[model samples]
Target: MDRAVQRTDHDAIASKLSAVKRGYYEDEYLELFCPRFEPRLPLINIGTWCRVRAIDQAITEFLEKNTEGKTQVISLGAGSDTRPFHLLPKHPNLVYYEIDFPTQVRKKAAIVRRHLSQKVELCDSATPVTLEGDINTSRYHLLGQDLRQLSLPDLDESVPTLIISECCLCYLAPESSHLVLEYFASRVAHLSIVLYEPIGLDDEFGRVMAENLMMRGLCLPTFQKFSTLDSQTSRLRELGLTHTISAKDMEQYYNDLPSAEQKRIHRLEFLDEVEEMNLLLRHYCVVFAGK
Candidate 1:
């Protein structure tokens, strides 16, 4: 398989696996071979996990408020996300479109099928509901076209649409990310994006943590430019999304974990260096937007 295809495949598989098994470490796919046996920092994990939970809650709320029986959801780079099936119990008639590169989409569909089958067969009371339509489409329904030259049609102007980018945005060049956002806002009646990423802490500890991760041969983020909360808020203002959710709760969560969990978390270089940066080392976010 092509390298890009392989990565996407991994993305879909890893994401779903993480969500399904509550106790599994998120970086296990990478750390399985090289385990972090040392005590880890609980605060670090708490901070990161909190952001993810917040995104899930925000999307869930959006679905409950807007979905009457016919709303559509487009999860960009929808790696192994089970939100579609999970949400089905709440709103069985809504349609979900998980879009990604072909290989990822194929693998995710297979996973979903296998998971549903096991659920039905193993659990006496389990009831499975099918997601509507063919899984693959050359022209996706929302954009239904290549993103490079995206220009969404106005035919479905009245439909309530929610676009989720998640952690996928930071990987794209900022310009490309911005263009995609612009396209969605223009086309969708309502839109929400959840971004989780590393930002510059500028403190000595923050810098050291990031560098130490690189030294340890972990995935180093290619894009490292981070803006202050004010700057980030301004950008969203330009895009007409004004709601904000700060990730500061994550730091607290990590710090509050029991001693054993804290050890696993503190082992990571980033967590150890957080305090050295004048408390600037942290996770931050903005979730509010208007159509």
Candidate 2:
């Protein structure tokens, strides 16, 4: 299961790469993380775009609102995501952290050192570095730690932080996923966690999606556990993020965007399967919380 989860990272990067190549969004540093590439299905590209769009919206909102002091963005189970690179330079006071399995972290570290070593200015702060524990750069710490047993000594509760789980925590056992959220909510005073996961597992669309994933050795333990947008937000509330919470499915997300922006994305892809796109979008939702 661990290995299967790791392979999803590759699929994620490939999907992103395909979208970028198709001009869905602009990312100067994204191609550095993708080693393998192939034209993916339009459904896959559409799903990838929704995932990035929702998470990016949550992140931009968090940083814009918390502009007073040093802020941090932590990506849980971050795999080949180039967000830190894109965000760090734009927000000078921002510190970005990526946590994943040890093997994944090591792989990412090598890529960072080889391709982007000189591109990003390393953080000069003394707050410990987490690049496989061998490097010390607070600006971008790449920690290789399992979310099931995550431990961080440098997290400052006083500073506002955003945690992102883009189709990440869904892979864990439902109880473990709750524990991971509880661990952070208990430690961080001002926090918001954004989650993107498939819901409505009792529906036929979900059952077929589950079967398709199962054939590829991928499974979402939380699909049935937190089966709806309400349940996703409820998990955040149960974990103590009771202040502000919101949930939106991807179709709603796209509709909520500026009309011009929505049209821009629509023009990028000739999605003939409009019904399929709508069906897929309804099954996945973004559940966010602020505290």
Candidate 3:
């Protein structure tokens, strides 16, 4: 299958799973919206949510520190996400630009419209009930452009900008990934990126996740591994992102869990027994920074 031609059904399912849970995206319509996208494994849902929570926290911190009051945000591959509604309440001065395929953008807009209408009934925040509605008017400017033939649009130099691509780099060919990061680093003054990837304990687990994705009729150009963190850091340095945070820093969040939960986490059967590295850390996420 062509890498860019993502099966809509599969993509929708992934989006649902990705968004739902506090500290996560909390989108409750996944099962109702796309039932055919079944997660064969049970823990997949919670595991994915935990990973997303980590990503959200990482990006939230970066943006809070790096973004100026008038900064703009570019969210690449933004799925059925509620970030505009969630993040904008606190940072009203910041402008957000969301980019995704036409279908996702349209569906998300409709949902935002419906939700905004019901916000008064559902939410307690004094933040205007129609804020989502107002933001929906300009929060997401749909861009149907593909990444391979991508270029930055013209914007003011004084406006500090941040580019985000959550769980997108894995789908990119290695060369394209490098070029895209370089492109973002060159265009933005202070930049930080959070890339949530499916990793393996070693090459073996990496291959397993790749195969699992392939079985779903998807292609993974690269499945990053925890062991390669050093190489990734070095590569980002060359790309002009001077700061980096490896998955190791976030390990504390998971490691500090209740003893029983940690035990359950360790027993996750997703790994290849032969892999020498710790399976949990082997396949996870990392944050990159460029100043």
| Each prediction's TM-score versus the true structure | 0.62, 0.94, 0.70
Q: For model 3, where is the 10-residue window of minimal lDDT? A: 131-140
Q: In angstroms, how far off is 37's CA in candidate 3?
A: 9.7
Best by the TM-score measure: 2
Ranking of all predicted structures according to lDDT, beginning with the best and ending with the worst: 2, 3, 1
lDDT by residue for model 3 (124-183), tens:
335333422213323334344456666646444456666676666666677877777777
Which lDDT tens digits does candidate 1 get at residues 1-291?
Answer: 224423643433443343323332453232221223333243334443454555676677677777564666677656555455555445644556666555555554554444543442211233333453224222122122334454544335566666676555544556766787777776665565555544544656557755664554443232354334444445555787665433332344345447786565445434344553225324444334544
Ranked candidates, highest TM-score first = 2, 3, 1
Distance from true location, Cα of 253 in model 1, Å: 8.6
lDDT of 2 by residue, 19-129 (tens): 888888888777778855688777778778888988998899998888887998889999889998788878987888899998998888887877775677654556533
Best by lDDT: 2
Q: Please give the lDDT score at residue 169 for candidate 3.
A: 62
Task: Please identify which of the two predictions, 1 or 2, would achieve the higher lDDT against the true structure.
Answer: 2
* Model 2 stretches with alpha carbons more than 4 Å out: 123-135
lDDT of each: 0.48, 0.84, 0.55
